[model samples]
Target: MYSISIITVGMNHLAYLKSLLHSLYIENHPKCSFEMIYIDNCSKDDSVKFIRENYPEVKIIENKQPLGFGENNNKGVFASTGKYIAIINPDIVIQKDSLDILLDYAEQHLQAGIIVPQLLNPDHSIQYSVRGFISIKTLTARILSKGKDNVNNKTVNEYLCKDLDFQKTQFVDWAIGAAFFMHRDTFAKLGGFDLDYFLYMEDEDMCLRCWKNNMPVIYCPQSTMIHNHLRGSSKLGKKAWLHIQSIITFFRKHGIKIKNSKEHTMSL
Candidate 1:
């Protein structure tokens, strides 16, 4: 039997955390025994006390100072005793047997260093969780289009890989970090996520490294989960700036040159 570690980092999102915990408790994973590792980033709410009183079985780590997403997750990884780690967000709710399904697929696909399940929106619509590499032009188009569904735009379509049928599992360039799964050895081999990325784009960086190392990053559509889908950067606030900074860091670190390319015709 494989032992799995489900690591989550939280800061003041008590309601979401509670919902996620409830969902995990109700979900079944007959193939694996799992442990929950919760890292509290010095939340202002009563999260610490609540977890202690309600979920005593959980291994909780309290940080005096708030740490970045990469740093906090790294801490949880270090403390984990499982062979596999599932890094998930507080707003995500796993579907019944999703964990077992993911583990089954991972066991079959030995070459895949990372695997992510299909994500659904709260309304049951498919969320485009997996995406191709990011570029300045793609980012600009996404920002300008805003809420007006740019699925028809060439850059946006390519960036989001709108042409593919998400129902069929395939290899993807990267998937959102909201719910990520990987082996402990693979994570350690890559040195985990880069500390330079405070929050956003760390997932992309990790996937890029997997590609560089000739390891596969797979998208498994058989299993699914519901994500509350919070677009923090869409508000164009401090979170947005952090996103842009992470993008710049990603491009610089990968030595990618931003260039304007002629737009192709949009397709469905």
Candidate 2:
């Protein structure tokens, strides 16, 4: 069995953490095959004490200074002893057999560098999880067309972001960072998520690296999880402006030309 390490950065979501830990502990897999690592991001609340008291088996990294998503996960990854790495969010609860299915898929597809499971909303509705390559046009359009909601017309087009059917496996540009899994070797070769991103775009950066390295980012729909997205930033005053900044930053770093080509830029 491939060793798997589950990494999570905890915030103030204690209730969700309880549920997540319960789900993970009760999972019927071989206990020796997997380990859980929680990097508490200096939560002001009682998150640290809660984990230490409740989940003594977890290897806890108490962060004195809060590190963003990229850095915290990097810290956990470096400390992990697993051959496979799973970056799971505290708010998400994966299906019981999801990890087994994902591992099976990974074993079958040797070229699959990263695998994203089907993500669903709390209501069990399919969440548009996988995405296509990034550029600048799609980035700009995403900011300009905020809340112009249409299920059939999602902003991303390259990797078929609108496709929610979880019946088949397909290649995609990137998967949502909410819950992601990849081989430890592939992660090391790609240098992991770019720490410069701070919070976002790291997953897209990793997917880009996988693509550039001739490894495919896979969407395995057979395995699925529930993503309880907060959309906190979207409610902020400068949500639109901040999104634009990230979009431009993505294009500038990737050297994508927006004026001449019609390629989609990842903005979410």
Pick the TM-score winner.
Answer: 1
TM accuracy, model 2: 0.87
> Which regions in candidate 1 have their CA more than 4 angstroms from the true location?
27-31, 147-151, 257-268
Per-model lDDT: 0.82, 0.75
Model 1, residue 59: distance off in Å is 0.7
Candidate maximizing lDDT: 1
lDDT of 2 by residue, 1-268 (tens): 3378999999788888887887777654433378889999888889878888988889989888877688899999998988888999998886868877777777777777889899888999887677666655565555455533342344544334664446777667787788888889888988887776666677887787777787777788888888887565554366445555665567777778422112323211
Give the per-residue lDDT of model 1 (tens digit) for 129-174: 8887877677788887882344578888777777768898777878
Model 2, poorest ten-residue lDDT window? 259-268
lDDT of model number 1: 0.82
- List pairs with backbone clashes in candidate 1: none
Model 1 Cα shift for residue 198 (angstroms): 0.6
Residue 20 error, candidate 1, Å: 0.7
